[model samples]
Target: MYDHRKLGRELGLFDTDPLIGAGLPYWLPDGAVVRHSLEDYIRTVERRAGYQHVYSPALGKRALYEISGHWAHYDEDMYPPMDVGGEQVVLRPSLCPHHAVMYRSRSHSYRELPLRMAELGAMYRSELSGVLGGLTRVRCIHLNDAHIFCTLDQVADEAAAALALIGSAYRAMGITDARYRLSLPGAGGKYVAAPDMWARASKILGEVLDRAGVPYEAVEGEAAFYGPKIDIQVGDHAGRESTLSTVQVDFHQPEQFDLHYIGADGARHRPVMVHRSIIGSVERAVAHLIEQHGGAFPAWLAPVQVAVLPISDAQEATAARLRDRCLDADLRVRILSAQDGSLGARVRETRLVPYQFVIGPAEADDDAVAVRLRDGRRLPALPAGDVIARVRALVQAHDTRLWD
Candidate 1:
């Protein structure tokens, strides 16, 4: 059984201090590398998919949540409002409200319909102490969140594209074994009192699931307050299920915020708000990934993508040259010297590194280095440039294959 909390500590990925309080674990340097890599990858993917990124304040006016229906529905899970400069402000529990405000900031036209706005933004949740066990549940959340303001007619296609994007991201992250769930409001929760809106949103999401030809379970009371969503669910080591990604169709927020766009007919029309997250939250996603790969991350996501080992002092200069090359190529690399341990021990210590270039006397004399892959595959001495190029290529491609 692989537990992320245990693996996280052992791998020096993250740590929590008593003074800092629970549910607020800070990332170590290596963990930050993993997270930054993931964030950069998401940004690249979002840009390619036509998502315009934005930055928003983590704190919002108390009225903002009230207008978005979050204060009324999700206040229990929210932090208490603080009086800031004679006005009440609180940490935002969701990014959708702020995003709604962004859309309403400027008028839109039919040509800009389906405008995808994305942000790797931070939000807060006042989770209980007991539930705050690791990165899975936390007070501060950095979410890979986005909202698409589209015409009512374009809702289905946008939702479908969001799901497809999530699928592709999961695939690239080596995440399989996740199940789809159509999350609907149950009869008992503090749901919005709009049955017609709920029905429309649920139907659109259901059709998107059907058109995608994927099997999903329709679970009740698992939806957001204002809409229905498709959740990509994954299990932890103890067989506990949690949502990793989601695509939701929301009609209530647009109405709440009075968001509109001018149509081709020159009349104002409501733009549907489609909420989607490729990865629900960076902390939780990294938690699952830590357990999934057991800290042996793929080449592109690996914190130390390459380790250069100098067998002895004789090859220290050679190792330095190789390390510089790796740094120039934008690879996360480290050099383990004989002072750390023997050549074999250094290799074993950095077992999680995707590539290890062993610099020995003969190899240095030949202007080459022997290669050792994480999976125990050893290659003969190859040109240092060729080795660096190969590793750089794999990292760029996000390919898991060590050598080809």
Candidate 2:
């Protein structure tokens, strides 16, 4: 099993200090690069899927949660309220209520039956220090969170599309062993108050998953108080399971919030809501990636993709030129020619990085580079253009684990 904390430090990803408080993360420069890349990738996918990006505040009025039913059902997980002027305010624990407010901001028609809104939302939960583990569990989290406002007629199709998006993201991350659990409220389960409504909602979600051909396990009584969900779970190297993504069908919130839209029959109707997160939390995903690859990330996601080395000070200029070329190609490149070391010693150091480009008099004169791939293969000489092209291709493919 991989030691995630050790790997995180060694890779210069993130750290926790006593002064920074527990269950909080301070991302280093390298760690931020990975996080930013992930956000960009997810945002691009969401944009293509018709999601409109929006921002909501971190703090909300206490009554917001009360209206959303979170105050009644999940108050223990929330932070205590503070007096902002005469009114009480609480740090927002979830984004759904805020999204609902946004939905209420404007009138809607059946013509816009499906409206998708996404946010790289920052959320806070009062987690106990004991449960906090590096980036996996933190008080401050950025979620790849989104909400789909759809008519009852459009819910199934929209749900399937959301599932497809999550699957594509997992595949892009090279994780293939993920499992899906179709969560349903139990007849006598924790929050099952209406058995008939629960049965109908469960059947609808099951039919949607079935029609989509999504293999899933039915989990009875595993849903939240408000609704059923489809959870995406993945096991870590230690055989421990974690939820990586979720798609929830909520029937209660819309009614509670009195959200409505004009239908084809010219009547006000409550729209159904679907909540999704392809990567549930940014911090959790980072932690999982650290363990999954054992600190060696793919080229596109690596903090530092290439380290350029010169045999000696005499080759510094040539190495700098190669580094510039790589930078121009938008590759993360590092220079390691400060110390007087043998080429073999330098190569060992370069191993710390995913890719290495070695330049010396012979290759510099030939307008070529000696490439050392991550898998211990050394191409003695290759045209500089060819090497750059290959590296770009590999980066595009997200082949960061190893050259092989």
Candidate 3:
């Protein structure tokens, strides 16, 4: 098993400084590269699914949470309020309330039955110090948050479509065996407004899950205060389970905020809300990726795709040109030319990186380069252009691991 916390620090991915407090991650340059790639991946997938991206402030007035029922049920996880002038303000712990306000901003007709909104929003939660563990459990998080507002008649179809989107994302990450758990509020858990509403929402969501033929176990008492949810759970190498994604069915918030739309009959009807996060928090996903791949990420996701090495100082010019070509192809490349070390030692050093490209004087004259894959496979003397194209294809396919 790979110890990700140690690897994160050693690889200069992120660090937790004493002065920065617990549950916070300070990302370095390499770590930022990984984070950006993750955001881009999610954006591309969500856009293809017709989600309109939006942005909201990181902080809001205290009353916003109160109206959303978060202040009443989840206040313990929220930060202390700031007295800005005469009003109280708090950092947003979740994006749902903000999305609710956005939904209420315009009058809607039945024609817009399903409206999808997405945001890569930063959120802050005041977590207990003991529960904090590097990027997996942080005080600050960038959430792949999305909300779907649809008419009651369209709820089942929209939910099924969201599930498909989540599955596609997990499959891309090489986590295909994730199990679904339908989480209903338990007798002891905090449920929104009334018990009957909780049961109704859970039943509706479960019916949709069944109709979609999704295999899931009904888990009582795991639901959020405001709704029932479908949790996507996956096990790590140690057999420890974690939530990779969630689709929550919320009935209380729409009524609480008086959100409504005009139906074909000209009657005012409340829209059903679906809250989802396919990748959960970006920080936790990064930690998961590090552990799942044992610090050796796939070719596409690896920070440095190719580390260029020259056999001797005489080959430095050629190596530099190769690095430029790789960079022009939008591939992350590193150049290492060591005159004092043996070629074997140089290769070993380059191996520390995920991919290595070794070019010597002979290959330079031949207009070819030697390729060394991450898993120790060597392809002798391939044209530089051919190698670039192959790498580009691998990246486009989201094949992070090498093709054996």
Question: In model 3, how large is the Cα lDDT of residue 367?
Answer: 72
TM-score of 3: 0.94
lDDT of 1 by residue, 92-174 (tens): 99999999999999999999988999999999999999888789999999999999999989999999999998888887788
Q: Tens digits of per-residue lDDT for model 2 on 21-69?
A: 9988799999999998889889988998899999999999999999988
What does the lDDT come to for candidate 2? Answer: 0.84
Tell me the whole-model lDDT of each prediction, alpha carbons only: 0.93, 0.84, 0.84
Give the Cα error of residue 118 in candidate 2, in Å: 0.4
Per-candidate Cα RMSD to the true structure, in Å, reads 1.1, 2.2, 1.9
Best by lDDT: 1
Candidate 1 to native Cα RMSD, angstroms = 1.1
Model 3 has a clash total of 4
Return the clash pairs for model 1, or none. Answer: none
Could you tally the backbone clashes for each prediction? 0, 2, 4
